[model samples]
Target: MVSLVASSFMQVACAADSEGTSPNNQDKPASSWDDISDKLKVATTKGLSKLSWGLEWLGYKSGFGEQCTFVEHPSLAVRKHLQANLKAQDRAVDVLVASIEAWERTHAKDHAPLVLALTGPTGTGKTESSNLLAEALFKWTKRLDHSDKDSPSGLLVFRGEDFSDNYTNPVSQYQEQIKSRLAEHLFRCSGKALVVFDEVQKVIPHTLDVLTSAMSSNAHLTYHRGGVERRIDTADVVFLLISDIGVAKMEQLLIQYDDRRHVPATQLENDVKRALDAQWTRLQFGKMVRQVVPFLPFEPQHIVLVIQAKLDQLSEYYQGVYWKSLAFDPALAPHLSTLESMLYIERRAVVRGVDVRKVFAKYGARNVETGPLQQLKSKLMRYARPWNPEAQFTVRLMPDERTIEIVACVEARANDQDKANEDGGGGAIDTLSCVSRWQGEFT
Candidate 1:
């Protein structure tokens, strides 16, 4: 293992040196031996850190000692991400920050894990918020680190439907399985795991009792099987429970306030907790939850921003793939307005003399990506060609509102223009022609 780590360190050092100096700088003076040695030392340190992390993950001790710890304070990163990407979720973001800060302060003491319940309507950023938290906590790279069936990347997900009682299997069986799985994973992770339980309302009471017990324990999670007792420390673990339990009441509150910004966050959270408590009277885990965060519905303007952001991302991707400049027509605002109408539904409630109104997505942002944006990607792929890699291509919506046209701006050179004039044709300096047309329904 030492030799393998050393070899990796050397490779990383060489790669870093090569990437630092481009081909254009080849004629410059070579770096001194001292500089190269410093780079090697830096690469070796990084390599050892990664190696230590791997060893620790596999339940092995590393020679590096405490330097191998991977958990980080994610307050700043998470706050910035939520502020920039998530809209109309100030209360949720605040609760998450407070929970993390509190955990940081008391993690050394033996205590139960922090349990947060995220309750809201569908497509209200519940999943996105959890993913962000995971990324920040573990410093995870989406492309490099991923969760699979065989192994978890510090983030474990469990669906409520998977634990439901069936004819062949009973709820008690699922409870035991979950307990075992949690114990093993928590042990391997050294209690630094972020476990997400989605659709919590669908989870049977029997299974929920098991989960509640795990969170309500002190310092360690104990499991006994085959007359053998195993205890795993869980002081750093966090449980994120996602549900749509009080969506109706939340919408009603939004309506009462006339604006989501005016809704009292404390009142909203208390109301949701009461609703959850009423529904799950058997376990009553609602009262035990550390915090209850609410995700409000999205307005029309927020939906427009989301759609535009998706298009912007697609444009950046195609620019690299097609090696051409991709541009959107400025006249797309009308089309975006039409799309916003199709994406969300409006609800109204009358309280006193005020008419409360709220808007939310019919199908969440995930559907938007899989539905219209996916089709848009396919159309771009079918039409985009690298014939003139330096030319600019404009994407436009047709009058029918269902078709898209890719128009290429082809500039006529002086020689081409002269030839055209000699051949008895109009000599145009700049020519715009429709290269490809894609006709499809949105959604």
Candidate 2:
């Protein structure tokens, strides 16, 4: 395990060093596709590392390759698409958009067209990848260190709001205007282009048909307006159709087919995942299967992974330093969990309007002095057991994970003993004392 971790660290270090190209320096054309692929692999690996870092912080090992995975397009397919659309007129604009420029140069222009779609459920990051690809192509080559899945980048996205025209009538009027405006923007930006249609299913069929020609035939979609017809050039654009309806439908089907009542954790996670997969199986859009990316719903485990990953990064950056001197304080664990639960669940049950202010101020320690940190301390105190009416339970962080486990058992027994002793006179043997007398018990 030590050797594996050491090797992983070394790879991360090496990737970081290579990522830092001087800002003034421009990316020179790579001699071969292999070189680009190798470089891209490093970037891809680094991107995954950040994702894993977030996962580990949530309290679990990264399952990126094992379960949480993204789809990848082959260099050959990408190159073929690029070469076919990249002509002399598009050379300047297309170069900036595509990373696999070398392979693209080899393929002939004006051949069979290429159209790629990125379809998935809501929040699975279909539109997000489009933005990331755009940013990687046009702005910085490296992915951002701190980026959310929903973070947008270089792609030009058109939402349903953009097509705010009468759907009852032919969409030619407003759809043409939208296409014309969008085409002008892409044409002006001399580089590779990406067009994302979020919730494409909501779009009118005629509008979708217009897009089909531009995507499949590599032919420009003409929009007639004001005595002239304008063409939206899509030869160099990667078209993406993102949707959630398919996944929603699949979820409904699963709810019916599988028993929804009293489902086990394993079954719940699997059913949700199966529902997402079914979405792809029932895909209806024309030739959408060729470009489909079935996004799975995030399971609790996934969120746990992200949190654990974040913790790992924090641990590394801090040189394994605990957040504070008391971060690991054993007293803090149970209290922390309790505090979190109190804050998260049944907010009304834990803290509310009047209780909120009282929580910030120590119950009896202070006479309502308003100090933020102290108040925070008071609120967290709610998690601790109220023993010895006058004594405040000292919240401590344990350095060892084992210490936490052992202390928890001790605390449980102590609470029971304290309750039992409460009936007895003030001077009495505590639970810890009784526990210490046990011959076989290990501390």
| Model 2, span 222-314: residue lDDT tens | 655577876655555556666654444323333332232333435433444454345434333465322334443332223233223333333
Worst 10 residues of 1 by lDDT: 60-69
Tally clashes: model 1. 0
Task: Give the poorly placed runs of model 2, Cα more than 4 Å off.
Answer: 1-114, 139-154, 164-170, 223-233, 248-289, 309-443
Residue 402 local lDDT, model 2: 22
- Predicted structure 1: lDDT: 0.69
Which pairs in model 1 have colliding backbones?
none
User: Which residue window of length 10 is worst by lDDT in model 2?
Assistant: 434-443
Query: Mind sharing the TM-score for model 2?
Result: 0.39
